[model samples]
Target: MTVHDIRAALAADKATVGTWLQLPSPDVAELMARAGYDWVAVDMEHGSFGRTGLPDIFRAIECGGAAPFARLPVAAKTTVKAALEAGAQGLIFPMIETREQLNQAISWAVYPGHDDGRAPDEPLRENRGVGYCRANVFGKDFDAYMTRRAPELFLVAQIEHIRAVENLDAILSHPRLDAIMVGPYDLSGSMGLTAQFDHPDFKAAMERIHAACKRHKPLMGLHIVQPDPEELRRQIAAGSRFIAYGIDSVFLWRGAERPR
Candidate 1:
């Protein structure tokens, strides 16, 4: 599905489901993708996989007709460039608490003159290194991809701290921001309430963030890390569009039970 499909689902109060991948194996990636996820995000930050085999993993996912996404550990330009080079169609940037961080992360994804008017605040042009890579079929489609299609990649800022909740408006206002996913554990941890999703403070923060997303156009996302069917339904009813349901490791230990 396209971003428009996600928006349509959100407009209808439906959820667009995706999953997470932490293992490096293309076998694992293909399996999850074939399992019917709209997208599968490789947890680069926490996944045991290194950068060398990202393209293979992504290819496997694509073969199953799913978009391959990356959950970046940090917003480093090199990391952003690497993931894009490896054919990541989407990116979930972690621990973003300020507009500057989010802006820089977006900048790294877009090439020069293709900023799409997103970095007006930046004193410099986009620093993304244009190169022949798997994303462009290794220069086969480089010209067209670099000039226009590259900007079509999905970019998400992960809201994982109380500070991000507080600054939602500024962060969400970015024209280049495609989506925002809530890292509930990190968000609660920042509030001195690690993993305490039931805490009133955490609940309040979620409400604020959700409201902020509604006020803006970015698709609201949530990580249902533990794969609770009831919780997933509840969150979808409450308007989460980009939903990450199961981690690859969790599916391994718990067995692959398709979410309802």
Candidate 2:
């Protein structure tokens, strides 16, 4: 079955929003999908997810008509390959701090031999070897699958640390970098504000990251907690193109708050 490309859907202004699945449960993922999200993210970075849990969560996400994305604990080639083989359609790499990190993230996500040293957005010089399974399984018919899935899978990088902010330009300018996401809490802590998004330090960092995204013209995103619609609208007006509304657990917790 051809999976819906969540990243492509969003790029087309198709209202693609996702909630994280902190636990590996197909039932929960199915319910969440029915509730109206376009994608489901499996949070391996902060959850109990391991190699054992990957396939289960990914399958659940797939069963829900929602694309599955893995937020890796770190941007390691082996880790990325593992999740992709498990059937994740996208990857969100955390704490990306340099251009080299972006390149590595792309290298890990894409097939090998694909790096013809050409510009990122440009056409490939050579069809890279299928060094991964997501490619092998779905992209087995390379030409057809590449036409459908190559641009569909997202290779996202998080901008949350002070060093990342300082290196934002070089990082964003890298051809392989697809999107830039903000980790407000981590970014606040990195800026010494420690969860204080209202602080000038935190605000400045966000602005810097936002401006960098605008300059680079890649997708810009944020994972906000209980985000006010107006505030979200303001950011969109200000330049953010991608936004994750909330976490899976938080959405569940809020729904449970209704008086019975």
Can you tell me which runs of candidate 1 are displaced by over 4 Å? Answer: 1-14, 116-122, 256-260
Evaluated at residue 94, the lDDT of candidate 2 is: 94
C-alpha RMSD (angstroms) for model 1? 3.1
Clashing pairs in 1: none
Indicate the TM-score of model 1. 0.92
TM-scores, each model vs. reference:
0.92, 0.82
Per-residue lDDT over 1-260 for candidate 1, one digit per residue giving the tens place of the 0 to 100 score = 44445546656766779999998999999999999888899999999867889999999998877888899979998899889999998889999999888877888888877764455556664668888999999999998888656877888999999999888998998888878999988899999999988899889999999899989988789899998999898888898888999898997878666676
Q: State the C-alpha lDDT per candidate.
A: 0.86, 0.70
- Candidate 2's TM-score: 0.82
Candidate 2, residues 1-260, lDDT tens digits: the string is: 12355555656754345666776666787777666666677777887787866776777666767677788888886787778777777788999988766666676677644442346564433232354454446546557555556545666788878999999888787766567778888888887788888888788788788778878856788886674678777776776765666777787788789797
- Residue range with the least summed lDDT across 10 consecutive positions in model 1: 1-10
Q: What is the lDDT of residue 113 in candidate 1?
A: 70
- The C-alpha local distance difference test score for the whole of candidate 1 amounts to 0.86
